[model samples]
Target chain A: MLIPFIFISACGADNANESEWRTLDLNNTVLLTLPQGKVVIELAPQFSPKHVEQFSSLVQKSFYDGTKFYRVIDGFVAQGGPKDGSEQDKSVPLLAMEGQFSTDGKAPFTLVQRDDLFAKKTGFKEGFAVATNNSKSGWLTHCPGVLAMARSNEADSASSHFYFVIGQAPRYLDKIMTIFGRVVYGMNHIQAIQRTTVIDGEYAVDSREHTPIISMKLMADVPKKDRIIIEVENTESASFAERLVKRRARASEFFYKKPPPVLDVCQVPIRSRLVKLQD
Target chain B: MLIPFIFISACGADNANESEWRTLDLNNTVLLTLPQGKVVIELAPQFSPKHVEQFSSLVQKSFYDGTKFYRVIDGFVAQGGPKDGSEQDKSVPLLAMEGQFSTDGKAPFTLVQRDDLFAKKTGFKEGFAVATNNSKSGWLTHCPGVLAMARSNEADSASSHFYFVIGQAPRYLDKIMTIFGRVVYGMNHIQAIQRTTVIDGEYAVDSREHTPIISMKLMADVPKKDRIIIEVENTESASFAERLVKRRARASEFFYKKPPPVLDVCQVPIRSRLVKLQD
Candidate 1:
């Protein structure tokens, strides 16, 4: 229940030169500061287009300005986008549900082939989780801190009632939902909300789980000095690959047992580091 | 994100009868009552030998009689352990960590291998997690509600202070840690705990996050009829497999768009029913 320790080894490999890092454009960045910590999200317009568009519009309109994180799962993810205060206050009609799984589980001899819902999967690529087949049709994946649209039976239901994936990859919903962006920094902030209510029997959708975002805006709208520099763990870099391999196999002496063979994309972590960058 | 509504075309099937149902004896059940609702966990002894053995012994001794579900993560998991409330609480020196990841990312092939403190990947079989290769031998995995030993640098440092997997699978820690048992039920109770503390700049020897579990006890120790009755979603059943596959693909019209192309073992849900069987 607690990620009490974020064991950061003395990798000591970070470049002291700031120019090496990139500053996320405010236009694409969403700062989510909750009780546990602060989380910044970088929307992926390339993946869920309509959702991204909707999110961008919401940011501009300040729709999430005073909303609460509302939900958080330790070691999982903290989610925001719901209005704060009370659920009794009805603002807009529930958002219409849209966005469908874009990938085709064509790979033969796999878990999906054996299961119906898993016939397909979703994952992150270049920070944008997309569901792709050899056909190249994809959507955003639901990794930790990924911002997504909350919908119902009707399509186009994303009206900022969003959620973040918290615990174990709920891949059963893969290819069946829409993911918009990921938390580029401060996911811990989202991991500390209190419970509120239950939705069906699933994790009761609680409003008290997390503190509201207070306000949300595209980094472009914030002052330039407020911008924070961040670096994505180069999943392609040798260091990144080594970390991945190590994560997949555990480099710690603590491991006397091993896990199953293959690594699923959803289980992989696309980490981002926060730093102060100045040219 | 909302889970797609699963419209059971039940063929209006005769719901399920005795042959289709398996009742958990109060004597064998662990009763966890939460503020919102109660959850019942069906223990799997095949996976965690030491922890299970310890848990059973403690249950017999009424170890967790008044323990509170101290930690709760929305999507991740809530963990309840550590004999709380005693003026002077001493740590329970648990056995050494078990389960080894394969040396070549092979044996536990089902386990999504990663790079960390060890070497290898393994997968899930029979609902428990294990990893292995030519040179190592052991068992342990991270499944939602999995009771695991919370240890320091020394592999044997785990004490009564334990943890659980609440949200999306964090398989990165597999095999590197020791998994004791899983929450067959009462997840909501644990998931409802308020994470009042924010980890600041990290703490060691397992700091603030190691909240206390008020107390716990096996139902058998309670009054005869006062005991709780629970049922686990039979994983070995055809219905369970059907649910997993059917839920995964989102083949129904409901899934206008899906997220990923795969599913992990932790996301596999196990339903609980509160019905008693006459002795």
Candidate 2:
């Protein structure tokens, strides 16, 4: 949906100016350079270490470059990777389920709510949306922009194909798909990919509609001058907590009346912005 | 975002076979015949009476005949109405804020959750998502496929433009926008509209991408022979509650592990299907 341009621009500026933010480690970041722009994704190894490792390895091997977003369901997910199954390397063993919560839950954990309807507890761990029944382990959520491995009916089938949440949080898929990362920048570019019409139950994007992945490179591989430095709001910080409260009971000038007094973690603003590295 | 075809087709069949359902009132229904197919929207006058009246009146007058979905944000909303503001008929007075809870403790209300994060109480009333702080009144929610009146910053400026939520349940818009109806049939048709790309901070759709509205007419206005009969699942039914439980702890064959133990109101399926009206 077309959000009011003013609202988005204002939010973008506010996020760019956040006082307390953490720069994403280059080793854990990947850049997807599309025709529209570059999208930077931060891999969450703490949640899905194996999936992260495999995804990064694939990136370094240039597995996804030139791949097309084969299946994009409006308000659902943008799935891209190998579609013909020709790229499947049988040697890359299929990974077991890595979707369930498995975090240390120590620092950088900002508990959003304790009584979340979707889980025993819901919060942000490190820089990703998380939900779990215990502090020992939690799964990454399916919020918009989340990167998750797509699998068939088999639990161990997730190997190459990955889908990104582009709509409402499909919490039902929380423990079913391995969420590995999130797009932190150039979401607009991703959102701008032209919709491909489905025909006779077949998801076929015409050659003209294909949004080609120009390249997928880990930040560490990019030259220092070419790398786009970014910092995400420390989700566990006090400022973030304050911001979450304000969003839940928004008293903004445009709001006719105060909205609901609570917010889902997805509704909370976890901002990311490009930053120039200090020389 | 694209969904697995098998999963979607399976869900489609399940939704189409609801045993206990309610046929939409012709007087309170509007059909949007597009290039792809027809979308049936059930108007909720009880929620926003004035907005519904105005919208239906505009439909009857053929105000939306050739309009295009001007602004469509993937995983957000699809907004469409008169763009040129030249169609404004001064006779139609501007609508006041009719967007808050206005119902009494009611029988049709199936309370989904008492501790809803978005509101004091949340549930479904007459097959539409509703939320209220008190037992006396509740407003329609911004669930997927919800039809809402859009306006500028002014609360009372809602006149012509309207939008359909095609993504996540944006609860932040709950008491803010006037949600007057919902799409009860042909959601797939609505979801099929090609997404317009955002260029230079503006929503732009190439002529090739535009999904033109062939016509929009109230069901009452359509000839009896041409009417497309459809029925939506009764939200207040016991079967719906059972379905909600199954969704929360989904043990389906596809699920690697059972997901969370709770269901958000939007997560619960409200099925709709084609039906033949007994002569």
Candidate 3:
């Protein structure tokens, strides 16, 4: 039972408290309170400005306070925000889906410099797992913990509903969905959300297992004393680059043979931590 | 509400019923009846002969009939076996870890021909995700749905406990753990297993929420009439190679631009179906 744990524990301990972690901005973050724990999401406004703006407004307005994770597919995604057939966002304008950013050589880049199967140039930019053509546009990828708007069949039908990727990185969703933010902390809480068992192709959720969102709010809306501060490893830092290399070909006592030489950007871990603010 | 669903369904429908699926061997498969549904696992003797043999013997002896999935990490693994910690295999000698296989030029190979970051060469041989150095040895990969043995800190400490990968491919565990089989069907049931909520760092599982295994039995042990036949896409078939290419650069109505021109073997869809037997 402890086999992989011991191996992972050793690999995870090296940079547990590295000083290179960059504190996130409260104004640009959202906090989701669940029965289990608190999940902090660092909003990505750089990639999808409209979607981020709408999401923050919805959060501030408490639009998602009591909504249940209506549809959760295990090894796939946990979706929420105004249950099915809900009328909470009827007045809200349907926002056009924003999936990619103009790459036209103007966007800031943190080159992962690896061959990616999903994008021509893959790396982190503005605190999001990003991929680009390296010339025209880039987009926030559908990696685990990514936050994206849930819409109907129409490309511009996205409104209040959103989902978080809680399973394998569904990269095919890239350039197709509007990824506005990502859960930075409490991934366990996201993983702990109840899963609906699919009978045939439809999933049935029991009300007893429904883990409702206690509240959703922008961190900025909360008082300074009550706000929880989080810091993420700066993707552009040299330490981050070194971490990527180490992850590609990890050589520990447990590993008699080294792993392959290539790495996908999604495999590059972005470590985050909770900390107390200095008075 | 339908954002990712619309995006995924279109991508999933193209090859839903292609005539490229290969039927699995009932003799080498195990059926795990869960509350959600029946999960069928195909044992891989070619990859980990000792582990698979031991596992089958234990299953036939009813060692895991009443065991609960004691440790389940969301987006990771569901580990289960004899929770009583009782000695079920006292008579059987503890088997040595069989993590990798001889990758010498003489070994059978099915080349994926992709630049994988985890292995020098990766492919499927005898119905398992395999990775190797191309000259020395290969091991089963930690792709989702893979079943592997669990052990202590010691490299040779594995015994009866086993786990299944239910989320993202934990490729880092490739050579560190012994992968003996893979879930050929009912993956949705595996994903629906209860998740332990980690409060702080400790996981808490509720007795009522715990999903117990109804029973475990090998398909060979059951009557032929009760057997469920599953056919997976042959990895070495021409159709599979063509599917891999289509997955890399899909250009459909949903996909405004062509996807990146690279495909991870893990991303390639291995289509499976339940076909009626020819009378």
Candidate 4:
């Protein structure tokens, strides 16, 4: 009889002290309501200021309401925006890609692994999976639940359309796409979104079968009484570093044969919880 | 406008010659029928012979019919088997864990990357993602769609319960669990299966909410007229190696900034397609 062990202990019990947890900035958080459930996304202005600004602006104006996830590929990404471009504000200029940025060595980086397959160093920065080159340039990794701007062949083409990674970490897209946020809650809802069928080597483009986004609103704009509070483990906190160390060591008694003492940056869990507001 | 490009080119066009695609062995292939769709799995007898034999025997006896995916954790694994142990045959003795094998240096291997975070070397063998230590001991990597046996605290306790990797590659379980097969087709269906919500850091244990398995049958037991043909690219084939090289180089014009040449073995696509039988 399998005991149903918590496979990835990263998402396990909330053992960290309250001080180690940081409540999400309501202004930077987006409440994306889908037909299934609400997905809470935390925008990363430090890495992708223009993208975050544009996305927040679009959300405030209800541009994403009733938009369908036009392109949802299993094991890749779920892209959603105005399907017919009728709802999009064409006047808003397409922003140049904010894919990667030079990081000062002092930036709060809790290292997860060195010599990553996609980058020289991999870790968590401000609750987002991050990869860096020679401790200089850093970009958000395409881990599951990452929010990135989708673009065409041109590097600077991204504007309103964005995607959420719904499957494996597509490291190949790490530096190529502009990632601006991560899902703090309701990742299961993102995974539950209907996927587009691929026929004859191409994704089915039928918008009718796709999942629809009911509406997207900045948490700051939502009424406090109706808002769902989300708090994530501060990646820079000492307790978080201890969690990473414990994961790497795999010191649990459940393992009959302990695996190698190494962990993928994407596998590191940044824990989040929904808090009920007091009366 | 986002071009909606084939993000993971591994699942893209069937450009390989007919000879490069190997038809699955009917005896080793299992056809799992879900209400949503059908999933085709290829059993790796070369690795875990006893586990495969037990699974195939159970499948032929209709042991997996009506079994529920009791423990489905998003971004981890989908576990399934006799929930109440009513259909399971208790006469069969519990088998020792066959988690890894000693591979001779002559074993056909198509290397994807060396110095993998979890393993010394990572590659593909017999159309399955694999990792090996010093080219001696080899085990199947727990990439998405891999079929592995689940057990309790004791490593050798695995009997009939098994799991499918549903999300990111959980490399930590590479050598700790017995991996006997992989999903060759219909991974989308597997991903689409209903997920058990985790309330307060614990997966919901109510089996009623889990997705039920309609039936599981060995392809060999099915009538020829009803069997679906599945062909996977032979990892050892030259064309397959060429495809890997092209992927590593990522010389596509679509890449504005070419990512690192390194490729994760789990990311390497072993293409499979369903073929209609000629009337």
- The lDDT of model 1 is 0.53
Using DockQ as the measure, the top candidate is: 4
Docking quality level of the chain pair in candidate 2: acceptable
Model 2: per-residue Cα lDDT over A188-272, one tens digit each: 5666554554422233557667777899999999988778788888875567777777776677778866664656777564677
Which ranges in model 4 have alpha carbons more than 4 Å from their true place? A1-18, A84-91, A197-205, A277-279, B1-18, B84-92, B197-206, B223-226, B277-279
lDDT of 3 by residue, A1-279 (tens): 699988777667744334466778888899889997788899888778999898888888898898888788666788887756656758577998798888766745677755555667788875688988667788888888888988776778888888888766888788878998888777767876777644332335676687799998898898788777888887766677777766666756666555455656665657776674322
lDDT of 3 at A277: 33
Give interface RMSD, every candidate, in order. Answer: 7.6, 6.0, 5.0, 3.0
Worst 10 residues of 2 chain A by lDDT: A194-203
lDDT of each candidate versus the true structure: 0.53, 0.76, 0.75, 0.82
Cα TM-score per model? 0.62, 0.72, 0.72, 0.88
TM-score of 3: 0.72
Q: How many clashing residue pairs appear in each of the predictions shown?
A: 134, 14, 6, 0
Docking level of model 4: acceptable
Alpha-carbon deviation at B102 in model 4, angstroms? 3.4
lDDT of 3 by residue, B155-175 (tens): 787888889987668787777
Residue B74 Cα positional deviation in candidate 1, in Å, after optimal superposition: 11
State the lDDT at A32 in candidate 2: 88
